[model samples]
Target: MIKCIAIDDEFLALEIIENYVSKCPFLELAGTFSSPLEALPLLNECGCDLLLLDINMPEVNGMDFLSAIPNPPLVVLTTAYPQFALAGFEAGVVDYLVKPFSFERFLKAIQKAQSRLAPRPAGGTGYLFVRSAHRMIRVDLDDILMLEGKKDYVAVHTQTQVIDTLTTLTAFQDKLPVKDFVRVHRSFIVALNKINTIERNVIYMGDKKVPVGEMFREDLLRRIG
Candidate 1:
């Protein structure tokens, strides 16, 4: 079972999340807090596997709170603001849920997070079975060049072809091994070995140019060398 905590200043919001957590057989709700500050100590002590965070809080915002935590648990941002979605993904949040979301939507998000945190076999050939339009396609890790985000969906660009899926870039990032794939932008994640050249703010993979975000530049440079 996934140990989880919910943080939101709104009492009703917290209640809703509590109800959702109670229903999920695989989830164990460790605690709930109105203050992000109070939640920090509990998180540090217990080391929760998942966090349901609110973007808008009193003293410290959700984004700032997440930044302060070192190696935070897989976060699912529960907020009314949709604009923070991209920034949340950039901050390594597993999923973003706009307030007043249906139970089905919440389940989908949690399932995605569970899949992300699930353990894999050691030192084996890492492959992902993705369902395309009509058939399930098995994709080898070595063939993937980069993953591009287009709104809610992601396009996995491989050496042979580009496969589109109704999934978030953050979700894909969680599944890919960090040593092999690195997220260089809110919209892009590239295979480390496939990098041909780095010039200014862009990365060259043969002829294609992928722009690197300012925030991710430092990590990308360190990886390149």
Candidate 2:
């Protein structure tokens, strides 16, 4: 479950967030506060995974509150003002929810959070339970063709489908078996047996052409030979 704290000056807004969070199977509401300042002590104590924040708080506006933290949790900004959306992303917020958003929209934001939150550890495991929009999917290791990094999401391309799961590629680096999977580039990890060819530093997995990083190319060659 993703532990989260909600901070909004509006009591009604906080209520809605709490209600929605309670309904989701994967979320746990740690606490809620009308101001960021009031939430600070709890935020420091709990080390929550996500923050459902509002941008226009009266006490200490959400942006300022976010900047004060040296290593803030993944934040999903909830605000009535759409103008603050860009600024929120620049501040490294995971998702932005406009005020009066439907539960469906709110859930989608949580889905984004799910993608970035902890995934089940994959080492020594034959399969992984990947997070989807509505449920967790069990994917076998041999079925995986490659993993493509999509900013905060990792697209696990298999023989039949592409599963977009939460977690950065850097964070996922150590999760796979070294003998089977190799990071051919910063954005791509390919199953060694699935690659058909490597020509001019590009890897071919079926019809897909994945570029090989100069730094990782020597390792790929050594492994292939």
Candidate 3:
């Protein structure tokens, strides 16, 4: 369920939104506030996936409130004024619900927020980040030749360079997609796509040769088949 909070200066507007939220199975109303100022502390403490906000609230309007947050939650603006529709979208709102909106309209807004929060498409560009030394480094899975485990640390061997990361081979294995990479030995993992030759029990990536463990041989052959 998407955890959400509602904020409106009008008590009746808050009640209507709370009721609408209750009806949606995909939504969970974490809290409701008549004053946006009073809701700030609760919002920070409870956390939320989405914010149902009214634009014309006293003290601080919804647009200004959302702008103040560095990384605000997905917003669905609720107000009688259609004039602020363009402004709301500029502030990164998922959807704008003109007040006195139907339950169906509210549901559509929630669905829009859900789409934004959804995970990226699978096989995501075949790249990921790993921490090396004191910094995070981007490593392209397609460019990786092999991975070698040195106890608590693992070295990622790419086409042009070797990156020593502060993570184990097992941990790296779990992160890589099974279709493009495989764990062939206890201390070694190889990129199946980058394998140039397999001689006896050894796999070769350019000049680098990695021994394939006996236990992983059958699975490797099956995958390659």
The stretch of ten residues in a row with the least summed lDDT in candidate 1 is 116-125
Give the winner by lDDT.
1
TM-score of each: 0.73, 0.56, 0.54
Per-residue alpha-carbon lDDT of model 2 for 108-134, expressed as tens digits? Answer: 887776765544355744777888888
Mark the regions of model 3 whose C-alpha exceeds 4 Å error after superposition: 121-225
lDDT of candidate 2 vs native?
0.82
Candidate 3 clashes: the total is 0
**Candidate 3 local lDDT, 75-186, one digit each (tens):** 8899999999866653446788997899899887777777656654576755779898888888877788889989679989998889998886745665666556776877
Error of 1 at 168 (Å): 6.3
Write one digit per residue (lDDT tens) for candidate 1, span 1-225: 999999999999999999988889999999999999888788988789899999899889998888777657778999999999988889767789999998898998888777767654578657897767787899998889999999878999999899998887877887886668888998999999999999999999988899999877876776667
Better candidate number, 1 or 2, judged by TM-score: 1
Q: Which ten residues in a row have the lowest lDDT in candidate 3?
A: 86-95
